[model samples]
Target: MKPLFMLLLTYLLCWQVSLGQQNSYTGNGQVTFSAGAPLDLIKGTSTAITGSINQVTGKVYFEIPVKSFQFANSLMEERFNNKYMKTDRHPKATFIGEVTSFSQNSKEVTAHGILSIHGVSKRRSIKGTLVKEGGKFILKSGFVVSTKDHHIESPKLTGGFMAEHINVNLHLQLIPENVTPQVATVYPAKKGLK
Candidate 1:
């Protein structure tokens, strides 16, 4: 009986450790968006992005607070939250899906998931690079968001200050759940990304 009990305890501990190693969470994630038109350009960035990933299951998830984004101009920020995004009504944008293809040797990954923004969800496939460094997995990706797809109407009243398409970039450093949390290295957006 004592031997059986010890075996069960060992099994449980191993299972728990494996599960923890398979899952990771972002310590500090950054999300940025850029929209440009012939007349003007709009850019915003947020450091409040949060998410988790399971390497074993290939499941990935991320969420960004709508109001967390900051703009260079205060008026533009207010208009973005209240008039455009209606952040009070829909406070978060999220993506939930799985990594369809990933190769540790190649460091290339493709994820298929549902991206939700402005209360609308759309199926999407996003390609990104993933690298393991210093006990962390770094993810970087860039994609475009269409205002029409998410029902974000860009009024002509601003004289084409907003573009119909917005380019988004993400940088995340994820640490395994079992590991001690440490300060993540934040990478700056690449030049000419817009």
Candidate 2:
């Protein structure tokens, strides 16, 4: 009985240590962006974020390809891709920076990163919460953006129908041992994307 008890205690101690000090810097992430006008406006989300987070230094960075955006209406999707976003011209919008502050044992962090859209990059300061659980990193970061700033002009048909200052929301779930996330071409790919 003594030997059994000692083994169990040692196992528990090892597990706890592994959860803490064994923190890793390599983790996957995601990005979600949505824009709505008045009525009949569409929203969307994407997961093409790729980057790393250093647990010790509290630095994190990620990237999401511009080609992963999906829309509710098929025609709208094409218009957004071929006209508004011009994904062919701008392939990616990346975020890179360090987490300046966080609470101890809380697992929630406030990270600051830069946002690059179109062929232009801007200094975007973002504040969000993070959790390291199930051997993965989950982040929810959101910000507002001006369509004109990124050169996102309304399509010819949708012109005068959309808003200039659009609100974007991002919810990223980065799972471990997972490969790159592809365009979610499933049913209603555009509903509530961002």
Candidate 3:
């Protein structure tokens, strides 16, 4: 008779390989803002930030598609996709940044990286707060940006409605990607998103 232990080990190895998947974590959060006037002029989010965090090196890799940005109103949607952002042509924005320092001895880390949008890339340094509860991680950060700087020309339709500088925020939570598929990240105020 075949060795019983060997038979069991073979069965387990086959089962594990049959359920093959990737090792990944998703992060999510929201960007609450006053927009310098609080006219519902902020983008909100619930994005599944797919990436890995290396504890030894402290590197964070995250990605979001340009088309993923959504708006609360129809006008907002058109204004974003049809006008300023031009998400259709330039499809995605990726963040490949590093958490150089953390305060929790490992809790809150400072994430600095390049944020590319509207065909222009800018180096941004953001303060990110993180909490590890279980098989997940939560990240929240926001920064101020001027549309003019990125050459985002506000369309004529606005009756002087658009603000010169918009407050951009990112609140995100991430989970192991192998557990979820086609995970969607939505940003309501992403008029200038991706």
Candidate 4:
């Protein structure tokens, strides 16, 4: 089921690019989570993030594979996916929302939408900065997610190993489909040297 979800996301990303729609951008993105308890520090990151944005509509979407997140320690990673996250049951996290008050002149923007994780969906708002450069849109944002809100279990045995609130950071560089030149289907028949 996880593989199927990933495949579908890939297909959608490709479709978004192939459509060649104006003001639409898509790219591979990154997400990171960090937290600290009294005794233990928890940190993980996943680069296997697929995302897209439609500037015209101020809409954005992101899909992240739970198994893709990596921790510094193998045992921690194992426990995260198997015990805490239960990746087998809920293998992916997704977000879909609209960027409110988005404007080409404004560097800061607010996004409001649904964030689904651990089989639970919750309304969330994120604040971030956007910069357009070299034909790419670079976005950065930070938000907090509560473990209890998503029904994530915190075992007593793992005391002080996890924090109640998780800090999530996002960095995305997106290329507009319309601005990218299409690959030439057929090379111009060898041009004769003048």
Name the top TM-score candidate: 1
- Candidate numbers sorted by TM-score from highest down: 1, 4, 2, 3
lDDT of each: 0.84, 0.65, 0.60, 0.82
Please provide, for model 3 over 49-72, each residue's C-alpha lDDT reduced to its tens digit, 9 standing for 90 to 100.
344555545677766665566656
Score every model by TM-score: 0.80, 0.66, 0.65, 0.76
lDDT of the structure predicted as candidate 3: 0.60
Which one wins on lDDT? Answer: 1
User: Cα lDDT of model 2 overall?
Assistant: 0.65
| Candidate 4, poorest ten consecutive residues by summed lDDT | 181-190
Residue 136 of model 3: what lDDT? Answer: 72
**What is candidate 1's CA lDDT for residue 131?**
89
Q: Could you report the Cα RMSD, in angstroms, for every candidate shown? A: 14.3, 15.2, 14.3, 11.2
- After superposition, the stretches of candidate 3 with alpha carbons farther than 4 Å from their true spots are 1-24, 27-36, 39-52, 155-162, 176-194
Q: Please report how far candidate 3 places residue 88 from its true position, in Å.
A: 1.6
Q: Pick out the ten consecutive residues of candidate 2 with the lowest summed lDDT.
A: 177-186
Which digits, one per residue and each the tens of the lDDT, describe model 2 over residues 1-194? 54456666666766665555444445444555656654557565565567666666776767767778666778877877777778899887777788887875775566666777777777767777777667767777667888777777844325556556656666666444323322223233354563
Model 4 error, position 166 (Å): 0.2
